[model samples]
Target: MIHAHLTEFHGLPVRYVDQEAGLTASQVAWRVQGDSYEEDEGTFADTFEQLLEWDDCDEVRALVVGTWGWAHNDDRADVPVRLLVEAAPRLPALEAIFLGDYVSEESEISWIGQADVTPLLTAYPRLKRLDVRGGDGLGLRPVVHTALETLRFESGGLPAAVVRAIGASSLPALRHLELWLGDEQYQGDSGPDDWAAILAGGGLPALTHLGLQDSVRQDDVAAAVATAPIVARLESLDLSMGVLTDAGAEALLSGQPLTHLKRLNLRHHYLSEEMAANVADGLRGVEVDLSDRQDPEDDWRYIEVSE
Candidate 1:
């Protein structure tokens, strides 16, 4: 007998992909448009409730929902957001939730509320990964304490309160953290100091790997990295594709107490030879990445000390 796997995109409908016995897994992609689906907005709540009654649905392995746009418009009768929230109770098997361009647009703020998030998060106690990009200004305080192993906050600004909540909540299972700042409408300026304060207060204690991309300020990045005592526990750190400078590198090396960091990336930065040497000297055992520099092939040589 051939086994089939079912996956849903934007909670529209489930698409089944045929799977062979023990070989590689097959990949399938499905896209839904408003014209193709006949269900109006008012019927969404019921439709979603019925869909959630699937016997095979023990947990949601992955959920990708629209945050804003036509799906979230107040005038639209068939809002997928409402159905997604309502369907949350049925997605006990959900392990990962991906919020796509739904949250990225500027017009869908009215439909995206804190209440909508509560049901889904409350329902998926086993949720491991949360990837949210854009939407109404949803505060992070409510969901930061979830049992997530990998947390990616992209293109949105995180407020201080939300930052504090993540620190206070001991996320023991968390291993990977990715912060992509400055992509959407943010409430506060995510300066390095703000991030520093967040780490000093203990945001991600169990993080073993971290990635930061598209940060605006270098000093803030430096300050924030310097403040993270948890870096000492990290095995890999990626700071590629950002506005990080030599000062940031120096701050991370000299200020931050990263004793266990084995791999460090400093790609696409403004690091001088001296700063590179300083970093090489500070992180003696760690492998440093200096790719994407003006002088890519240049070797980093640390200063010699004679007694």
Candidate 2:
């Protein structure tokens, strides 16, 4: 679902330089096969090992993983996950990681196979940020982590289990959490009621920004979030990249006093012009995003990402 490739991660530039090109303190590079289907001379493991043995390996603090191999055969990132977990000791400076950073052209978000990243968290107890893009074969267990600050799952169809797993997990220092709940056809089966734990602010004490976006039943999500206990503490709320209508907007506008929020992002929606105007007019002090308005197809609303 991601169109653009990453230029930076964890406040460092992302590059594709070779070992011969040398590494700098301000940037991190990834070695990817030119073509997803091409048989690379060296596998991803080779590149990872090379990094571990690099003279400047200690300087590497963040990593951005791109194309792994021939994804047409459903190439999974399981090996990479294992490699990263095993290499945790060597990557002590590592604080952030973007697993599955490929764009749609390299691999469709839904088609990109991922694995249980729970072990990585346990291995890297100091890891503060993790951004994973893809849901196919993805896994997560509700494990408590004290240092994690941000966690994101970018998927076309985020499995319902993973959604609930995040809600059930205990993250005390988590400041921002973004979950893209793609279409059910791609595996995301979560509904409004599923967001209870997260919405209720069960275990997330430092959560200031929460995004439960790109859902099939966004109206219900909005309705649930309207009265959810989490909103009171969040400085920003993102309900974008889904099929939101006036009904959902009405619930948010009428329910809670959201004037305390600094930003309310509802981009890529199906809100009526009147409702859009109402949202802007209602949240005068709050920064409201009402861009990328879409027209329903034969009365059928479509989400931004549901592959």
Candidate 3:
């Protein structure tokens, strides 16, 4: 099974509008090109036109988008990316954007196609957070942005190349980085070595939160992260939504002292009760989240967000 569609983004409730109306700064706007397979009725271009015409368009601070065309079948719809690139100048207060908000009913996480995202960062200097889903044709160029603070990618099968690119990129101000590396069934094939650059914390001086979630080989991540140099500076770590068993828990507990961290997320795991208890006892003061204990049948452990 997959996760639910986003109800909130960047800490704000999501709102979908169709007409000119007053909008608050506390909510983010959402638009999809088509719903129920309508061709020309609702579209990215049409919605953009409508959005620009709103009385309070300039007051909009955040936006969410998904499925520019034929969402369920189309793997690469580069039109929305181009549309956003062109619309950047008109959105004055836009600070955050979320791409690919569809759930399984619309498109699987791995089915959403993404384009090169370097241009968005270049265009919106004020943009602080960017959350993207789907990695099928996803492309990103190493960028240096001063204002960007949070970058996250959600995928059922994140590509190895994309993972390597993120590790190689230079994000000086990025404080939170999360990547959902699903199983190989979709396109996920990255290993611990692929993200070694990120683990080493080369250009990320402000990073305090790291999430290597939703992977099949979570044990490998745990083993490497336990001894990684980045852990020394991190305030929280998320190894959730993956097939983490007692072996992974043991590696984490034995490798480094996690008592300094403020949070450790190990939800939806296959760890034994004893190992789960050990994790809680090991990090006494930390806000350890060990919820969603799984009961795997025939020793088949599963991840949360893979198709």
Candidate 4:
């Protein structure tokens, strides 16, 4: 498993590979395009080959896979997944991967195409962390892994079936889980009930950090999370970048005993300053983030990433 060293990248904490210390973190990075594909930079396969060529191959731990395409039209989903499959056998020390690093300018989070990621998990038994963006055609059927500790799926409109698959998975060592259930407007079909099932299920016995972020139905989610049995074991809870309002915050403040949490993120909300402060006060010792206050006049609410 990778021991991620915290480093700032584009204002966020990411993991950068450190050969000397055998430490790595996920950082902002982009793979070069294939030479035959109009851009003569480099292909994902080529970059991976370079990584394999290093003398300290056994020391490398983390990788942030990105694309060089300028627009949606230039994105090629097949090559990346194929190259990853080809490279997995040789990446013995690899433990963490952040697939699809494109931002809104390159492609919306929902627009980025993704292949089934189950094979990667099966190939690497030591893998501990996996972060995937874009949910189109994404599937992980009944995965039963041992070393996996953190799993994050950042998508706008995550399908209900995928949510069901996650709830049914057998990852006993998983400690962190985050799912961005976007608006139904973008194909996000998982409703409050789907989330309730995930929370109620005992699939992830080791889970502590939970993030149900970037949803149009955030208030409903917050209301559900307030009473979910999973909250009792969580050390961190993130419900940011959505339509969280005063009512939802009130549910959290009034219902759950958030004193055990180490961190609580409630950024990008529709809460008034008074309400934000009130919620912050409720979780006295917890590190709380209530930034990016939204005005009610902004009639329509949106998730951070949507196609």
Candidate 5:
């Protein structure tokens, strides 16, 4: 049966309305409420343990936990959070876990702040994707080594060190890496060279597609792409929203023979029709895109290459 709680409903009994009906594939949604419950500490611990020990618990495909309200300054909820983390190891068949703000109104405490979700990621092992936004400073560096295929960092400000760390690590199974740098503070200057070096050092060899949105410079973007040894293997290169000019694009496409590059996105730039035509002519097999900028009406004209 599906389970949903409108308040902080941990330690409550699982109400099976029809015991003999049997449980089908179900989803559980919990909402945290700011009400006090009777203190049955020992029973609560036992119940949590029982859930962890259940062998058939692997049938659970998805789990959603929502938190609302704030814990009193003197009242600590670390123990329960630790138990939740420990119980995560029992979910051997879970595919996805989403942690974010679902309610329209903001709560006094962050849901992630109350739960130890990072430990759960390490323990779960089979988790393929994780989406997290707006937490109490959860460190992603610790769990970057997971067998995750798709990882997205949205509304969170990642430091240059963290970005560099991801670039340095080995992620063979990783295919898609999306980093969204929303309005948050960054201290150090992490330019394109650092990103280029990271990609060159084998950070993302298996990555066939990459998207950079907001706060990325054109030269840095070009340098990063040009430096990557695997650029030749990429099927698509998207640099739609950056400071790319004719010079940057020329620098990127000049030396390399991007035979596999099928789609090139150079939108939102000041490239002229003549320059765009030149870039298009250079890549014989690729489709050049210079849309929504200065040169949108240029029909691609190619010159015959001499034998």
Candidate 6:
């Protein structure tokens, strides 16, 4: 009955559905609703519980949980972890979950607070994909899960400790990973060295798609990623929605063989028109995206998603 609130995307395209909507999967947001902006009709947990009470709750495949009417004031706000842990048994077929899908109009990504989510990984062993937004109090402890295939952390200011935890994780089945390293002004503190450690590690043996997007230090990240051994094994790489300059593209040009990858996404960058053309020329066969060029006049760089 509540299967309409779920969707599964393999990458840019949707691939799976739980309900027979007779509609293309691309059009569905699969989001659960909350109350009015001024009224506290229900929290994320309240809506989740309502779904869990349904007879076909186990049919839900991919769920996007977001706040309806309230903005989280702190870490311990909206959608308690315990409720999910308790409902795991009922959602046996659940595979993908995107926690905190609030937009700027609803609540800015930076203001969308979160808490430790390590238990959810353990609670839902069948889960294959997980995307989380916000990083205020978000924590993913070093875990050894086998079935998880995709893991993403989207934040305005991703913490250094969380990066270390991901580096220490034992996800042997992971295939796609993305980390949005936002500006330091919003609390993003992880440096290039931290990312270097993650790239050097052998824990992610099955990773094929990698994304280190939306960073103030895009040039540094690009420099590090160009030389990282992980690049050789990836089929697609995403460095979009950040402040990448010509220098960063130069590092990519000289360091790695971009011709082998299926796709390279470098949209929402600050690269010069000449360098953009060069990138397009260099990777002729590869599907390259160089749109949304931003000009930094006052030495100011903007991350794609922030308050």
Winning model by lDDT: 2
For residues 1-307, write the lDDT of model 4, one tens digit per residue. 0112224322334532223234332222213233333566665666667666656565556666666353345464566666766777676777777777766655776676776788778878888888877787676676889899989887887877777778888888999899888877766788876786678758888999989988888888899988999889989999998899888988888786989999999888998778888988888899999888888557887666667
- The TM-score values for the models, in the order shown, are 0.65, 0.94, 0.92, 0.82, 0.59, 0.86
Model 4 per-residue lDDT at 221? 85
Tens-digit lDDT track of model 6 for 146-243: 99999998888888778888888888899999998887777788887778757875789999999998898888889998889988888999999888
Runs of candidate 1 with Cα error greater than 4 angstroms are 1-55, 66-82, 101-119, 142-146, 156-162, 183-188, 201-203, 257-259, 277-284, 294-307
Q: Give the 10-residue window scoring lowest on summed lDDT in candidate 4.
A: 1-10
lDDT of 5 by residue, 1-307 (tens): 0122333212222232122134532333221122223343233345444444445665545543333223323223344446556667566666555454334233322222433345655766676665543334434443445576655543323345445655766666666665433223332234664465445637566776664433335555665676577676677776654445676777777757765787777666556667777777887688877775643244531111000
Off by over 4 Å in 3: 1-4, 24-32
lDDT of 2 by residue, 155-239 (tens): 8888888878888999999999999988888998888767888898888999999999998788888999999999999999999
Backbone clashes, each candidate = 16, 1, 0, 5, 4, 0
Model 1 C-alpha lDDT versus the unseen true structure: 0.51
- Predicted candidate 1 versus true structure: per-residue lDDT over 1-307, tens digit per residue: 0012224432333332122123211111221112223434324234344435545444335544432234344333225545655566665656766554333233332333322344444556777876554323444544445477887654434444444444555566788877655422343245554465435536566788886554545446666677676666778877755566676776787685665778887766667778878887877888888776644244532111000
Model 3 Cα lDDT, one tens digit per residue, 101-164: 7777777677777778778888888889998888777787777788889999888878888788
Q: TM-score of the candidate numbered 3?
A: 0.92
Q: What stretches of model 5 exceed 4 Å from their correct place?
A: 1-57, 62-84, 101-120, 134-138, 142-146, 181-189, 201-205, 266-281, 287-307
Q: How close is candidate 6 to the true structure, as a TM-score?
A: 0.86
Clashing pairs in 3: none
> Which of the numbered candidates is closest to the native, going by highest TM-score?
2
Taking all chains together, the TM-score of candidate 5 against the true structure is 0.59
Q: Which ten residues in a row have the lowest lDDT in candidate 3?
A: 17-26
lDDT ranking of the models = 2, 3, 6, 4, 1, 5
Clashing pairs in 4: 15-25, 15-26, 16-25, 32-42, 157-188
Q: Which stretches of candidate 2 lie over 4 Å from their true place?
A: 17-22, 25-36, 296-298
